[model samples]
Target chain A: MKITPKDVAHVALLSRLEIPEDQVEKVTGQLNAILEYAEMLNKVNTDGVEPTAHVIPLSNVMREDEVEVSLARELALANAPEQDNGYFKVPKIVEG
Target chain B: MDYSVVIGLEVHAELKTKSKIFCGCSTQFGSDQNTNVCPVCLGLPGVLPVVNKRVVEFAIRAGLALNCEILPFSKFDRKNYYYPDLPKNYQTSQYDLPICVNGYLDIEVNGETKRIGITRIHMEEDAGKLVHSGNITNSNYALVDYNRTGVPLIEIVSEPDIRSAEEAKAYLEALKSILEYIDVSDCKMQEGSLRCDANVSLRENEQAPFGTRTELKNLNSFRAVQKGLEYEIVRQAEVLDEGGKIIQETRSWDETKGITLSLRNKEQAHDYRYFPEPDLVPLQVSAEWVEEIRQSLPELPNARKQRLMEAYGLSSYDAGVITASQAMANYFDVVVGHGADAKAAANWLMGEVSKVLNASNISITEFAVTPENLASMLELMQKGTISSKIAKTVFEEMVASGKDPATIVKEKGLQQISNEGEIVAIVEAVLAANPQSVADFKAGKDRALGFLVGQIMKQTKGRANPELVNKLLKERIN
Candidate 1:
């Protein structure tokens, strides 16, 4: 599970991080250290152990099967970076 | 070289908890962009997450629904990542231990039942949305909306048991219907509330180790999931057949081109650098708590479908359609509860209501038709107060104006002509007018009987009772 310098570079590209070429080495070292610490988990005899996806086991969480109030136009657009009237404004999504 | 496509799905459904999984932020969809958010959800400096009790409860409910074994003790882990959508540098998700494991969903494909094994159902927070700026291809900047962030999500990962695109779609549809029936999520792909990512690979036969699988990410619709997986399967098969090594990578579906293009190489599972989330405490679910959730759990889709078949004598297709959405199923029950015929109500819902909703691209909730209104309309039909044809007309007016069924019937004067003397006179006149049809009916041209009935109905202005008219017409013709 040791992450090489190449691993950091790959992860950076996948995540779209603007990492400078020179800083790749430094970031790789830091990442490798984190990976090394994480490797300690393999020390447990988890051969038959199950992987956990959720902490609690329950099923069939449902509402009352009714439609409640929808967010108002103002509330829906309140935090938009840009808006026109009460609608969220975005650049034209289609080309003519 | 021919090959078989092997597909698996990882569906991420937002749980129906009132709050976020790891924070107290409301799990409500369509909330103000950040009004439901809190410091913990924002991942502010020095703030810690307190696991929502309902998150665990919901996860267990999902597990139980899938018939998965519930872990006695499960814990959260930090999945390290950096993205604008992810407020926390690391996402709090289950890693080494999940709430539910080793479940299976039985889906029918082409009338054959196939059981897809569910590997796990893990809980996590949903990321925020990224709205692109000027251009989608090359946007200057993207606006981040955190309303979706911190919303509880359960990722249901299935084993690679599916062998075709149709099977994949069927499995997803069955899963979606079940989730909707259980009231977990709206499971609306358009809303990004229920999303699917598919993993596809092709194999020659069972003897080989698995091929390098490509992950198709963020397919918002079932059609897209099916098409994306199909395209990938073909693309990978062609590549491997040409002696090209199939690269393990994540790809994006270019919906316009109907093709999948490379997004990024597959990240190793270990690349996540997962560790137990320190801020949230390990969840200890009591047996009593699990039992309580189980007791509170509604009848799942499969069980309800069976009950509908047994109790109401509904056809399997009708039962399946009615129970597809919890809302629609509950609506069906309401109408039936009001003394409407099961088969009759199912016919209207599956035929009329569903048809209208599908054509309008609206949900059942968007229409003004209530269950009581539908039941009363059907009752009018049963009581011989309105002909079936007239009932439909009255029902439309009811939908448009939300008027009472009786009022619509009264206003429209759509009552059936069930008076025996009146019906017999109309039938006699029709028979006398259609001598050729009466002669043909005597000659055993059964279709001529239909013509006679049509004439009588037309004379009565489409409100003639079909059963009564037929009885009178038969007697008069004889």
Candidate 2:
């Protein structure tokens, strides 16, 4: 469970980060400290203990079947980096 | 190249409650962007979540419907993660002690009953939607809309019991139908109401150890879930065959490209840094409360299917179709409540009514044909006021214009020609004109009876009573 410097480098690559070399060492130390604490969980006797996924015992959340109004085109496109008409603008996704 | 596919489904359904699970924000979909949001939903500082009572009730109802055991007490936990769409850095989900556990949903595929194990059903708040601006090409920065944030969502996780793509699709459909029947959620995949993530892996038939599985994300439709699993199965199988290890990872299905690309390395169960939620109090559900919710639970899909078979004397297939949604089943009862024949109503609802609903891409609730109107339409048919053909025309007009059955029948002048003299004249004229059928009927060819009846009904412009016409034809033949 020891996250070494090389391990952090690989994890960062998998996570799609462009970390500078100096920062990689710093992040590796930070992640290792976190993992060391997380490893303490192995000490607890989880044998036959169910892993908890949610605190509330519930199921079948639903809504009524109806068509409500959608946001206006302007609102939908407000945060877009680029747009045309009502659609979000993007680079050519496909070649002609 | 013998292999078995192991598949599991994680379904996230937005519950049907009027308000968000943790806040007072409206759970309505398609509201103005961010209009349904509040400080709690936006994760503003100083706002704390107040668990919605209806959220717990709906969950208990769902657990009962799925035959899950409700825990006496449960608590929420923080699943810490950094994501732009999640206004809160961490999602408040159940880390352990989910609301319900140990349930099974029996699904039928190709006439075989496959019992899929339900691991857990837990409540959580949904993340906001990320609106990626610009075209598919060079896109501008994306905007995050928190309208859907904090909506009540129940994530139903099933044990990996599925073995094929078709079975995965069947499981989703059956689950959606059950949810729809209980009126817990709309379960519309197109509206981002119900979404699915399929976990897929391939192994040899007798392999002791399972192969690495890939999680395919954001499959919004039944077809997509099936197709995504199928593609991943093929992809993993090919990888393993080449003596390459199948990587554990999260993958995205490029539906247009028909390939799954790795999105990120798979996070182990410990990666989320789960801890008990500090803001909300631990939920204490009493047995009496659980029993009350269980008793209040509506008749689910299977139970309703069984009753329809017994009470209405319908075939199993007919019952299954009619009981797919509570709304449709209740609509049928209303028609039957008004004294229309159950079998006739079932046939009409399954046939012409369902056809129109599908063609227009809407549910029965959206159609203008109310239960009373449908009942009266059937009444017209029973009383011989309109022939089946005329009844269909009137039913369409009733649905289109929201007109009453009698009004449509009156305006269309579709009364059945039950006059005995008028029917006898038409029968006599048809018997005289069709000498071949008359000769065939005399020779006792059983099908010739149908030909003679057709001739009379055609001559009468389909207005004659089919039963009376048949009786007259049989008597004349004798």
Candidate 3:
């Protein structure tokens, strides 16, 4: 398929991205070109083959149920845009 | 149109792991905020997440308990959603290929067994808790506590097979019991270890297609789950009957108000663009490992209830009550192990023990009376060493002072007045002191004889053997 301007806007909204008003058409064209480039795989045929989920062949990368030290309160809250009483403050979410 | 209620539940239970799912942070609840956060769980840049082995093991165990088929190869997918409680922009969960699938759990309703189909059981991480600054509706901002972040959770999704709210509650009770038996998760609703979101709808009889479903949330207890489902079923039915359509959305159960309020409309929908997590490797659980986990499983609640009923000749309802909790079942078994009669043990556990537990708001595990002490107390009553009335008094003393039953009986002089000579003397004193009752008994007045017996018992401070008192009084009167 072909990409539409509305589809690009919806995708942008879902991703929380803001495309400039005039750049919508150009950006949609660029993204559709990339999609077309990626869609070339549709031409390949591999019947009776399993879909691959991981690129690496390794499996079961896990750690034991052990406790490691957590970051101190100060460092854990270091990058918070807003902090109050050792908590990360966010915009009002009344319906939590 | 006549409608039948259809319900499906998605439950999330936190695993009882010592550490968080992806980091070394503690998974302890109610801890100081932000204390259990690490660079990995905090979603800091340049950090990677390692899956927890115990989490997968627990998911498999829960699957086996639910009689699900385990998938040898499974992987995680990122559920993309932006929320304040979730520090990461996405949640790592199993989407298409969950670890366990096609499971079924049997629930008993009105002495009939109803099987609920399990669609899948997948592993995920718990989101952090959001604490509103003021009243939730009036609050201007919310604070995030990362203490619960990254806690391992297993989401068990059930097929829409439940027909009523009672069945839904039974399913949850059975599920919670199995989780407790397998020792997978804490499964406490109050502490937020176990949470449920229900999908409910109403269709006209079984011939029609399933109706549009609404997801119900914030059901904090089993009662809430049942009551909320009940209310939603009626609400949906009323809406459909009024020639209106049931709008699909998420509704929060106002537990105090006893009604479900719509929180979000379906017009603004969520499309979680799921993709395989590239950081974590695919998990391959061997068949041998699954078999090992199955072997390690304890006797589940249903089978244990069956055995308890068969072996002890207990009623089905009695067995259900006794086996309600693992601790209570263990206590009963221990009491039987100490040579106490099974039926007698069941009676006391269901009656007196439950009374104390409910009154004190404590579990059987924290009860001061030991199984051995209770068994010995029962033995004392059985052997006529103490009257049943006196034994209750001694039981209170045991709970208060933590003393042995025999010691309390001996110290309080609460033993049964079973000696023939001693009771005979009291009987004679009662008879002589009340000639009027003697004359009345000779005149065929049974009330007079009962009064004399009562006087004898009161004279002995209620320690007199009731049977002996009756026999002795009848012998004298006749």
Predicted structure with the largest lDDT when compared to the true one: 3
User: What's the ranking of the predictions by DockQ, best on top?
Assistant: 3, 2, 1
lDDT of 1 by residue, A1-96 (tens): 677778777777547587898988888888878878888888888887666544555423323322233344465455556864333344442222
TM-score of each: 0.80, 0.80, 0.95
Tell how far residue B374 is off in model 2, in angstroms: 2.6
Model 3, first chain, TM-score of: 0.88
Per-candidate DockQ versus the true complex?
Answer: 0.09, 0.11, 0.72
Q: Is candidate 1 or candidate 2 better by lDDT?
A: 2
State in Å the error of residue B334, model 3. 1.2
What residue runs in model 1 are displaced by over 4 Å at the alpha carbon? A1-96, B27-38, B135-137, B268-270, B359-362, B365-367, B403-411, B428-453, B467-478
Which residue pairs in candidate 3 collide? Answer: none
- Candidate 3 structure quality by residue, lDDT tens digits, B1-478: 6688899999999999999888889987778989999989888889989998989999999999999999999999999887789888898899998999999999989999889999999999889889986777788888999888889999999999999999999999999999998999889999889999999999988878999999999988999999999999989989999999999999999998899998886545568889998888899999999999999999888898999999989999889878878889999999999999899899999988888889999999999999999999999999999988888888888888889999988888888989989999999998999999899888988899889988998999999999998888888778
DockQ of 1: 0.09
* TM-score of model 2 vs. true structure: 0.80
After aligning candidate 1 to the native by TM-score, how far in Å is the CA of B123 from where it should be?
1.6
Residue B241 displacement (Å), model 2: 4.4
How well is each residue in B94-205 modelled by candidate 1, as lDDT tens digits? 9988888999998877767789999999999888776766555566445656667788899999999988989988889889987876667778798888899998888888
